[model samples]
Target: MTLPLFPLNTVLFPGCRLDLQIFEARYVDMIGRCMKTDSGFGVVAIVEGDEVGSAPGEFARTGCEARIRDWQQRPNGMLGIRVEGGRRFRVSSAQVQPDQLTVAEVEWLDDQPEKPLTVEHDDLATLLGALSLHPMVASLEMGGEVKGQQDLACQLAYLLPFGLAQKQVLLEMDDPTVRLARIQVLLEQLQGDLTA
Candidate 1:
């Protein structure tokens, strides 16, 4: 499928959630078009660039396909959109389209590994559960039971006060188990620091 591409230095994975403010003229049109269509768009991790709109050929080949979960029109005529990460795909090629939007020909990836969560595998859960109660973290824990470790990881990865570098690490790691383990370590360190 032809996808409107949003390239950023950060990566997005399936079963994750992303919040984006559409301020660029090109993206405003892209969002409108996606809203019109049945299926939405894609976001690739920009590997070499600094951030969004820096340059092309700088993004990673694989990215998550996203659909608009929710959105509202902002006062500035842009969109405040919440994207729920769907499947991962590889960009075959990209072309600059008519409305300054980038259209990418993508090949989708389907490898959903459902490993049941274990207490031994998820030491992060205890800290995340506690942190989820904090006023600063409550917004992220919305809409679900606390038992989902995948959701917990995604929420904490997005909501935790970590730098982009740390998030990029989580994003680039293709193995979900490894990512969770790393996040566990990071959370432990963070908790220790906070208590110290």
Candidate 2:
């Protein structure tokens, strides 16, 4: 299916969550259009340029099909939207539609199988315990809430001030097991930093 493409510097995976401020004139229109119809949007990892372009090979191949879970009109008059990530998709090609949104030919990625990887849940526990100690996270009261394994991994990856390269790595990983492994490594690194 083809969709209106919205490319950003950040990458989103399926079953994750993202909050965005829709202040840009083009995207404000896009959000309104989506709300009027299916209430969904296509989020692509930005390679270059400000908006999704016509070149088929230009944008990142993989992205997430996201739904607007909640919308709020900010005091500044722009919209604040909380989007829930739905599924992964690859942009085959895109073109600007008359309504001012860029439409992309896309193929959605399938959900990866749950694997019985030999994980010590203690690793995750250690990480969350450490994160709870951070002043910023503590102030936000994100410490005690129970996040599922997959959600925990994704949320930590999102909140960590990691570089773009690390984020791209998480996006490129197709298997949940592998993604969990990468998260484990990142958690270990963060734990090491705390001890140092």
Candidate 3:
């Protein structure tokens, strides 16, 4: 399917929330079209480039669909939209419009079966609970409670302080168990640093 692409410096995982301030004419028009059509846009991590202005950039081929959850007009005349990450997809081809809006043909990633929260997830869940209390995280309304191990794994992988590349890796992983295992290792290393 074809999608309007929004390349950002951050990686957006399925089931996470992203808040964007739309100012540029290209995106302003894109959001308007999406809302009118009741469709969503694709969000990819920018390998290189600025979010504003005409900046030549490279973006990851894999990304998530961002469905608008709420929208409002800002006092500064900007569009404020809160979006929740939807399905994962891989971009097959991309084209940029003269107005700097990127559009791409993408393939949707399939959802994996749900897994129960295992004992392996205990530390990561605790960490996620603590992180969720932070003001920035709290604003996303993710809260401490969520359903399924897959959901918890995806959210934590997105919320953690991992680099863009690392987060991208997590986003590309199809298995929640493997993702949680990777997160547990990262969490252990982070905790180890604290004690030293």
lDDT values for all models: 0.71, 0.70, 0.89
User: Where does candidate 3 have its weakest 10-residue lDDT segment?
Assistant: 48-57
Candidate 2, 130-186: lDDT as tens digits: 887888766544535444555555556655766656776786677666677787787
TM-score of each: 0.75, 0.75, 0.94
* Candidate No. with top TM-score: 3
Q: Considering TM-score, which of the candidate structures 2 and 3 is the better prediction for this target?
A: 3
Q: Per-residue lDDT for 1-196 in model 1, tens only?
A: 7787888756665666677888878888788888887677888776665444534656676777888888998898777998888877878988877655678899886644655677675555665666667764454334244445556566567666776667767765666677788887887888899999
lDDT of 1 at 159: 61
lDDT by residue for model 3 (1-196), tens? 9999999998888889999999989999999999999999999999988888873489999999999999999999899999999999999999999898999999999978787787767777887899889999999988478677789988998888888988998899998888888888887887798898
Q: For candidate 3, what is the TM-score?
A: 0.94
Best by lDDT: 3
Off by over 4 Å in 2: 51-58, 97-100, 114-119, 125-149, 187-196
Candidate 1 ranges beyond 4 A from true positions:
50-57, 134-137, 140-149, 161-166, 172-174, 185-196
RMSD, one per candidate, in order? 3.4, 4.1, 1.4
Superposed Cα deviation of residue 62, candidate 1 (Å): 2.3
Which regions in candidate 3 have their CA more than 4 angstroms from the true location? 192-196
